[model samples]
Target: MNQRAMIAATALTVMSMGLLAVPAAAQEKEKCFGISKAGQNDCASAFGTHSCAGQSKVDMDKTEWKYVAKGTCKDMKGLSADEAKKMKM
Candidate 1:
């Protein structure tokens, strides 16, 4: 293959591989509440006080959450979305 053609083919192959990996990675993680350190929480809070990641004012806040590996939340003693909501109430 010509130089430019080889580069294009390599880029396309890499892009497709990355796309295929995303869903599989996503499936391997789940949102685990009350596990993140202060200002280290992922994407919003259960109480709606913040709408962005890394905004938790307190460590291990029930309203804040991080994505933990699937089936490991209980092992980490992390709360579910419903459980976190009840704690905030």
Candidate 2:
């Protein structure tokens, strides 16, 4: 390969490796309910009141959640998905 082609190939390979690392890192996270501050939650509200991140309107709404490191939710006094489900009923 020409020098330009070779450099591009190397950069592309590095980027692909970074992409492959994302899923493994994601597995290290867990959703911890009732812990997010207003406008800071990661994704869909648990109560179906909203369906996007960073849209919570109240601090620490029990139906709002954000991703916490796996296994640390309880230490943070946050509920698990199962626990949140029960509370919503």
What stretches of model 1 exceed 4 Å from their correct place?
A: 1-26
- Model 1 vs. true fold: TM: 0.68
Clashing residue pairs in candidate 2 (N, C-alpha, C atoms within 3 angstroms): none
Model 2 scores a TM of 0.69
Alpha carbon lDDT of residue 28, candidate 2?
84
Candidate 2, 1-89: lDDT as tens digits: 89999999999999999999998787888899999999999999987999999999999888999888898999999999899989989
lDDT of 1 by residue, 1-89 (tens): 89999999999999999999998787878889988999999899887899999989998888888998789998999998888778878
How far is 9's C-alpha from truth in model 2 (Å)? 22
Candidate RMSDs in order: 3.1, 3.8
Clash count for candidate 1 is: 0
Clash-forming residue pairs, model 1:
none
For model 2, the run of ten residues with the poorest summed lDDT: 22-31
